[model samples]
Target: MAVNEIRLSRLLRTSKMDDSENTTSFDDRSEAYSEVSARDCLAEGIIGLLLPTVEQIDERVKSTRISQLELRQHIDTLAEDLRALSEKQQIPYDLDSYVKKLVNAKRRVVLVNSILQNTQERLNRINQSITRENERRTALLEPQVSTPSEGQ
Candidate 1:
């Protein structure tokens, strides 16, 4: 059995040598193996490069969500501030309406001023006319009052 095993080992070694000697295009096969290995290495390197970018994109997305939440909170705070300011200033809720109301109030003030000026002018004219009429009446009565001595 030992002799057979030795013979088998010798046979295997000789067969391998024979196969190597008989193989054609050995360089071509080696070149093909090297090309496949190089391609595998390049693929692994490309995947390595892409993995960090994917992770960075994930991080940015998470940060964007946090930023959006902060923006929402800021907006809510601004709205509350606006409400408080409106209450403090006795302003209307809608800005457009408040502006309109102010404009209308100004117009009304202008109109009332004009009316008051007109009424004042009319009163002054009437008072002047009354003064003139009183002076004319006094002039007419002075002669009648003076003639009372002629009858005596």
Candidate 2:
């Protein structure tokens, strides 16, 4: 049948032959058979023990693949979220430039207001000086008119 079975059968047949023709004793032949049987049992036991380990390794590989897939999904989700946030933060105009322009406009307004205030102050001073001169001239003319009329 199988190669090992054929070999074992051949060995058994040879062992059963007349002892005078074969120098091997009966005890020696029996001992050899027992040794071969022990080796086969040991080989079978090792294979049986290793089968579960192979299965466990296969299961672990599958689990790792699943975890990797989930991690990839999470990474993709995070990437999408980051992209959305980027889009939301993106503005059509430059905010810093706009703020700078506003600041410049405010400075210009302040400067113009200061100039207007200075001009108004100068005009008020001129008006006050003219009023004082008019008052002095009236005072001088009133005394002259009174003296002239009394003499007439």
Candidate 3:
């Protein structure tokens, strides 16, 4: 059995030595054992190229999520700071005007996100807001079911 295996390996090696380029071409069936398929090679190349794109997308997503969270936190801090400012009568921020601006800004966010589905989290935020609005509407429709505008 060992002798047979060695003999077969020698024969295969010799066949490979005689046919280099011809063996590499796809049309040759005898070379199938030694050659790689075009599709497999192409897939490997495509995946190699796509790795960076996928990694970039993932990084962008992580950064966007971090920024979004920071923005919301900053908005909360603004509200608190505004309250403190108003108490001191400094009037740096007009609460009514600032709130009105943010409210409309929220609406614009929704509008832009609704039209642009490719904006993933940007769209997700709008969808979440819309869902909350729907929940509020449903609760309002039923006075005692859950009560509209419940606390977070």
Predicted structure with the largest TM-score when compared to the true one: 3
How many pairs of residues in model 3 come into backbone collision? 0
Per residue, candidate 2 scores C-alpha lDDT tens digits across 1-152 of 35356446545564665647646576686677577557655754665575556556545555654555565556456555655665578564434454455456555645655564565565555546555655664465355435533544
For 1-152, candidate 3 gives per-residue lDDT tens digits of 54245335533443544344564453354355234234434544665575556556656666665665566566666766766777788545557778667656655545544443355555455446555655664454344222312321
> How would the candidate models be sorted by lDDT, starting from the highest?
2, 1, 3
lDDT of each: 0.52, 0.55, 0.52
Q: What TM-score would each prediction reach against the true structure?
A: 0.40, 0.42, 0.44
Model 3 vs. true fold: TM: 0.44
Error of 3 at 132 (Å): 37
In angstroms, the error of model 3 at 2 is: 26
Backbone clashes, each candidate: 0, 0, 0
Candidate 1, 23-54: lDDT as tens digits: 55555544654574466446546655755565
- Which is the leading candidate under lDDT? 2
Better of 1 and 3 by TM-score: 3
Q: Model 3, poorest ten-residue lDDT window?
A: 143-152
